[model samples]
Target: MNGLTNVSRRSTQLLRRSLHTSAALRDAAPAGQTLRRTGLYDLHKENGATMVGFAGFDMPLKYEGSTPVESHHHVRKEAGLFDVGHMVQSMFRGPTAAQFLEHLTPSSLATGLKPYQSTLSVLLNPTGGIIDDTVITKHTESSFYVVTNAGRRDVDLPWFEQKLKEWNTTELAKKEGGVEMEVMEDWGLVALQGPKAAAHLQSLTSHDLTTIPFGRSAFISVSSSSSSSAADTHLLHVARGGYTGEDGFEISLPPSTTTLLTQLLLSSSPTVQLAGLAARDSLRLEAGMCLYGNDLDETTSPVEAGLSWVIGKERRSEGAGFVGESEILRQLKEGVERRRVGVVSEGAPARQGAKLVDLKTEEEIGTITSGIPSPTLGKNVAMGYINARTHEGLHRKGSEVGVVVRGKMRKGVVTPMPFVKPNYFRG
Candidate 1:
């Protein structure tokens, strides 16, 4: 059978057996709870998207005309637009804003991050477990913009609010400057991703796209052709980074200008088609990016998740004293019981919760957290955790293991990831 046909048949079988629960299903809106809609809800519906409940919101799973595999491949080879407006955006300001943020996350925000630069960070509990993964940008020394996962709103928002109140009332904050946070409600965020993204986006604005290197951001004016009473141009906050491991930009702007901006991006090139959650999932997985509820949670530590790079060198030496620093430092110095790793398996594709066993003993050692048939690699790729002791000896590339799929053992090997090389535009 062809790749698409094989994938379709396996997906059907997996769905029928309920072998793996989706991240969307895991975080679906509670019964009797109303689902929220992003600013682009009408546009998504107009485009014939398949809507599903995700993170307490009605989100498009995929466009009706495109399969997940097709959308995934399209984004890898060309460019694709994704509506990610459901994510929470907030602005923190005040003289003590940087200091306040420094105490909340493990990243060296106060020392390492420069103005207009962004860093991927994790909110931590006091015990050093992850609260949520977030992208924080330093707009200024005293001003910041943060974007966090939509599914983490319930936990993240309350934590930020409580911390802000506490920090504002603290003696040090009073001696310095107090901090305040503003949630950017009803805003819009769209990700334009792939190899050709920069060339297409450069045509929309006068700003030299080449100067805004990876992990940096800029505010650029976007000209629109939509001849409504609305302004002919609008300023948007565009960041040069994305989850897809591609050269891309994530544009954030007011709700009123979202549809026009999206239209402009789509019309920029023939390759820029609309993508949705299904494609987003597979792309991120191939990029080795973690999905919050699936690959990370309140119980997981950054060191164990292979995110140790997020901890700054200065923080490690000077003990930056962020929340969970003690346990995190301990883990960094000693080691974790298990470490997350990538896997490539033969036979059927392993799904989340599939048992990973030792090939020789057939003993369960770990479980698959995320898995998919990669469009870029044309192989079954997965991310999971293996016992650190076993990982040291047997988790190298080409080391054979067993992944239990529907009670059958499938041959698999521990492999290095991003399964596909990342095409980030660093320059």
Candidate 2:
């Protein structure tokens, strides 16, 4: 405990120095307009986090004593805790809840997923464009727990309200029951990510973490003797997966216990330091995960974004299904003009909006949606769309490409993602 305390104090003390400082990095909240906060906001300040505006919330961009690279590598090596309470958590319940979700997403949620299994799915617009990527956990056939990106709150909530109303007026709703959405507002969410995450969290719960595989969740009771975050016992939702492509859990607990729960997790081990958005972004990018605003949008389809796997093969085989089934089926039948792929560029790391050009023709093929110098690989890795259909073999793996950084073309190669192998524990 002494070591943890010393690390915390030194972290905050150096946070005052603002390593790799940004004008936006400050201790105080951003001015101009009111910003929302998670239940763990107080805990973040106590731990010496440098807060910044993100997804309409005052979130920690990074903590002291560790730069983005340092924190990124820390989570890769050991466990790190993250406050993700700003994400919109919600529940859908009714006799027709499963049917409603299947309509909203392309996943065969109602039929394919067994109880308590979670799938990474995408909400779609009418024309097969991605509305937002989401994780939907089917608690039961008639119930679900969902987590969507906080940045899409404005678009998602309204879409839900409109869709629910429309669905309720249908013959299906009259025959079965109208689905209802219960938004889990102000709920506390934290992700414990790393290869060691499970071992640390295992000490606090009697429920065997070994039985809980990746893409599954369980309601478990947690306790900490040195902490008073919750009562003597607390039942929380522990989803055994995370954004970092590592074995971890995204635990959702009551808002009141947010800070104490975080403290409790920190109390469990010395290495489980608090990480921030800076590390989260780079880690996810390295994991080959999509950022909603950067890699996905209202204009991009799952087929084009290389996320067709998110759509169950069974569903894709049935053409007359889903909201945008027609377009999605058409794309699957006839290929898309472009595909999202990985690129390892030379000279410099590609940035968002960086042009992807053909190696032979130097013609613009696509744009880099996300990129970073991978801490694990020590190489410039990126994800971008490639539209070199006419120049056959250009988008294929091992083919040379170019990522235009500044005005010069940096040689790159079409590579298989994730740049770093995911360490998800299957057993």
Candidate 3:
């Protein structure tokens, strides 16, 4: 075998050995109450991960030897893998499923989105508030795969249950088989992200990675480079999109093979380190992607979050019969009172709940929703909502502003979002 393949084999061997220990597996879960554990819990601990509780799961926040910023920069320059299995994954399948789901969001899932394509959409409440931001993938006309933030699980699950019951009980249920919601509990989801991510992952599968462009997906068989596991290929649902705004793939596979698959990905020549939640937060913020609880909530609407594009063009014109069509349409025509925007400041990094003031008047006009010291730009980058009525036309790009950090006003500007330019692969 070639030297590169040999290195991969050895890496996989080490991973398998480290992951099989019962002590690590047992200790990975918290002692008192039952927090959730992904299939890779033991493997994360084996790699010297710093564990933290998030969204009711024991998750790795960062790994030894790499700070969150270091991991963030690595993902931008090369590649990194993230365990995102804690997020809720679910399937909506049965006849008329598309019609049923379309009632929950303004996305044109039943018509506009092609089979195998995905869209970043929001779950809307009756008042046009965002219930959650979710990625919805159409497997067929009647089968869809959805992923939503784990932090919103308490809210999302009940919404799904109630809505599913309403739709399944309607007349549509008698003519076509009612839609069924099946939670993919314990399924494994990982993102292989960065510029080199595609090339790195290409070595494992015979499927032409090029065919799966951004927002598209395909089921492909992948095997570890190790000779012992080469023949045991596992089928994975690979979607070519990510929260980081980098060109990447989110692979979903059975829980049983989560560790093996992760090891297999890490075993690629030149290697990609395992990144955790902290790095992911900064990366996604740099990418200008919204974190459900931070940048969005039941009190916010997609329009106010600068995600109006998520509303389908045709759906809008036709008055999409979705949950909050009236309120959203009113906002679309008349405009929102406040809108989400990017802010870059000259002082300390702004964190959530930071107040924003008009620099000239020293009047509070907005609030920071998310922020970080951008590793790529070396600046304090933030996302926030600024009220138009409070400071008319003052939140436009380059408008002078002051972000209140630690009770001190720091000079800043209303910078256009995606603090870092996106590198999403269109091809």
Best of the candidates, lDDT: 1
What are the per-residue Cα lDDT tens digits for candidate 3 across 133-237? 899999999899999988678789999999998898888787888998999988999999999999999998889999999999999988765454746878899
- Backbone atom clashes (below 3 Å) for every candidate: 0, 0, 0
- Tens-digit per-residue lDDT, 1-427, candidate 2: 9995664444333332322222222312335757889998888888789897777788997787776667878999999899999899999999999889988898988878889999999999989999999999999989999999887888899999999999999999999999999999989999999999999999998899988899999999887564666656889999999999989999997877788788999989999999998778778877899888778888899999989888877787665457888899889999888889999988866777789987777888888877776667867788888885766677789988889997999999999988888999888
In candidate 1 the C-alpha lDDT for residue 217 amounts to 98
List residue ranges in candidate 2 displaced over 4 A.
1-32, 226-230, 317-319
Best by TM-score: 1
- Tens digits of per-residue lDDT, candidate 1, 111-144, equal 7999999999999999889999999999999999
Q: Which ten-residue region of model 1 has the weakest summed lDDT?
A: 11-20
Measured by C-alpha RMSD in angstroms, how accurate is candidate 2?
Answer: 5.3
Give the alpha-carbon lDDT of every model.
0.86, 0.84, 0.84
lDDT of 1 at 214: 97
